[model samples]
Target: MKEFASIDIGTSYTRVLMGRMGDDGVIQINGAGVSPSQGVRNGGVVNIEQTVQSIQTAAREAELMSGLVVEEAVVNITGKHLKGENSRGVVAVTNRDRVVTESDVLRVIEGAQNIRIPADQEILHVLSREFVVDDQSGIRDPIGMTGVRLESEVHIVTAGKTALTNLRKAVNAAGIRVTNLVMSSLASSEAVLTSGEKDLGVAVVDIGSGVTDIIVYVDGGVFSSATLPWGGSHVTQDLSFGLKIPMEAAELVKRNSGCVQIAAVDPIEKIELPAMSGRPPRWVLRQEIAAIMEPRMREIFELVDQELMRSGKKNALSGGVVITGGGSRVEGAASLAEEVFSMAVRKGNPLPLGGFFDRVDGPEFATSVGLLIGAAQSTDTARKAPRESGSGWMQKLRSWVSENL
Candidate 1:
């Protein structure tokens, strides 16, 4: 059995999960924790001390629950600083008789890594989208195939170096070694999307507290990824301004009475506004809240639509859109998205993982749970690497990179 842990640092909260994958292939969750985040803004670390405290608090709770210490973990990263682009690599088969081996595959992927990037950016993930062996295109795997020419198409995700350095500093201060850093949208996809959806072409939009994350998959591989600077907090700000309430009150109202579609709200439904500053409580029609919320939510969806069209994969989404994360929890969000995208839309809840699954089943916990999934996958890769090639760390990385292929 291999034990694994994951930490998801978000603008609103910090979450940790501990679990293990048994030798028999069963994945069991053992512990989990969540705490209000501090020193983080829009997924960037602003204060190392406060970020360390947040991570430690959450990690301690998880360790207590599982009766185990978390010394290392897979961590999630997000923000507008993340960039995803597609690149192609081509190489000739070197062996006699033209049989493409794992070495050829590795060489092609390394060639794909030659992309030019900004001085302050570093590659985070290189996911193979497809392989072509000679004349055969769209081949998922080309290893052991007979081909003189091998081509690889991959999606590369990069993050700002400064952001990553600060993030690692916070995690290290918390006494946890960061094993891997997975993008928030990619992790959320592992938690919410199914094989069918990814194979048929789909977009996973994770609307987080401070920023929205997007990743589109076509033919079971990443096609495009983007991060929008605005997110659910902007909606709360709009409600605060529109309803003449404090931010705390606006957040409360947005959670309880929020609906993004005016048509979905009941005409007579009303909710109580908590009394504040010695003012008596007041009643606001739920539809009135929706009225204040609709325009802002519509604007968010429109922006996402523009991004999809910008990716040029808007029409290729046969599986349409799946919205996850806390921002998508508002009532009528799906209806509003359906209207804007002119296609099917659905809420993405985290898929069940058995133990503690009930505790983290909501869209808000998708990234945390997905981090655990990534942890198991990485462990699996490491365990199989030596058997595959009798090599060390480089082979493990190659296996990790090839997982998407």
Candidate 2:
């Protein structure tokens, strides 16, 4: 049995999950922990010390519950600083007379990795959506195929080197080795999206406290990703500004009364608006609460739509959008998304792991669950070593210079 620890350092909270994958293939979740986030603001780490403290808190809690000390963990990365781009590469099969081998696949992926990146960033993941050999499309694996020209289209995810370095520092300070850094949207997709749904085409939107992450998948892999600066915190800010209430009171109102699409409440729908100490409480109509929230929610959907169109994938999604995270739990968000995208939408909660996971199976836990699942799946063949075409990083540097200079 292989035991691994997973941690999700999210905008609003950080969570840790410890699990054991038995030899029989059953994954047992032994323990987990969540702590209020401090290091991240809108998906970027602004305060390293606070972030380290949060990670330490969660790690200690997980160790306590699981009775196992965790020294390494698969961590999640996200925020507006992340960028995804599509690139295509074509490689001539060197040994035309011999059957294509795994080396050929690696060569193609290496060819795809030839792209320009900024000085302060590095490519984190290169995921192939499909492969074509001699104009034959939709081939998942091209090995043993008899084609001279192999082509591949891959999605490359990049993150700022400074951001990653800081994250690593914080994790190290918390006394954990960073096994791998999985992007937040990809992790969320794994936790909430199923294989069939991805094959059919689906967009998973993780709307957390500070930032919203969108991941689109079609034909069985990630198609694209987008990060928006708005999320649940925006709603809280709106309530605070519109209701003339304190931030904390506004937060309470949003959680208690806010609805994304319903602006007008029935005459009977009334909620008590808490006031600051020494101030009189106010009786507010539910409609007033919705009135403040609907526009912001609508704006978020509009921005998502605009981003989809910008990526030239506006009409490509077929399974529609699946919304997750604490923000997704807000009432009327699914309806709002449907109205904006004219497609089916559903709220996503973490999948039931059939063990200790039942306690943390909510949208907030999606990234954490994804981290664990990623740690488990990291052992698969998908993670192959790069062919020694001069180290992958060196090749990336050369490619960047070729394009930028």
Candidate 3:
């Protein structure tokens, strides 16, 4: 039994999950933890001490439940500083028989990664989208094909060096090594998206407390990704100011009775507003709360739509959109997303894994669960082919070694 761990440090909460592969090769959850996040804002660390405390609390709880000391974990990262773009590279085959080999594939991907990046930024992922051999396009695996030239199209994700450093520091301070830093949206997609969805073209929108992460998939690969600065917390802020309540009360009210679509709420139903320092408890129409939430949620979906349109892949989304993360738990979110994107929308939850996994089966656990799955898959891949280099953090390390040492 091989154990794996994952940590998702969000603006509002920090989650940890520990799992192990069973004889059947299915990952079974052994333990899980969720703690309120502190010293973090909009997915960026604001106070290192507070963030460290939160991470330790979450990780400790998970370790106790799993009865396994966690030394390293695959962590999730998201912030406004993240950027992504598509790039292409072409290389002539250097084989005697003109057949493309594994080495050629690596060289082509390396060539595609040769792009100008800011001095303060580093690449996070170079995801291969398609491989074109000679004039034939859409070849996922070009190895063994005879071609004079090989062209690769890849999506590159980058993060600010400062942001990456801060995230690593916070995780390390919690007494856990950071094995890899995965994009939150990408991780969420792993837990919630189906192969058919990825193949047919779909967009994954993970709405967290401080930021909304978006990833677009086309032809079974990431086509574009972006992070919006606003998220569910913004909606709560709107309700707090609009209803003259404390932030805590606003959050409670939103969770208990908030609906983004006014039409979905019963006109006669009223919610009791919590009494404030100088104000008495009052009854407010549910529709009023919906009014406050509708605009903000719509704005988020609208921004996601704008990003997709900008990517020139908006019309290519045939599988619609899947919404996950804590914010997606809000009532009417899918309907609101559908209205804004003019496409089908559905709430995403972590794929079912029997056993203790039932404890973390909600939308909020998507990223954490996805991280665990990714770590397990990476470990399996490494065991199968020790010589083949994996992507993401491994690729970054390889580049660093070649450039620095």
lDDT of each: 0.88, 0.82, 0.89
What is the lDDT, from 0 to 100, of the residue 302 in candidate 2?
89
Off by over 4 Å in 3: 387-405
Model 2, span 26-110: residue lDDT tens? 6678889889899698887889999999998988898899899888888888878789988888888888584666667667877
State every prediction's TM-score relative to the real structure: 0.95, 0.91, 0.95
lDDT for each residue of candidate 3 in 201-312, tens digit (9 for 90 to 100): 9999999999999999999989999999999999999999999888999999999999999999999999899768777779999999999999999999899899989889
Which ten residues in a row are the worst by lDDT in model 2?
393-402
**In model 3, how large is the Cα lDDT of residue 368?**
96
Q: Taking the candidates one at a time, how many backbone clashes does each contain?
A: 0, 0, 0
User: What is the TM-score of candidate 1?
Assistant: 0.95
Where is model 3 poorest over a 10-residue stretch in terms of lDDT?
396-405
lDDT tens digits, residues 67-117, model 1?
999999989999899999999999999999899877888889889989999
Q: Model 1, residue 310: what's the lDDT?
A: 87
RMSD score of candidate 1 (Å): 2.8
Candidate 3 local accuracy as lDDT?
Answer: 0.89
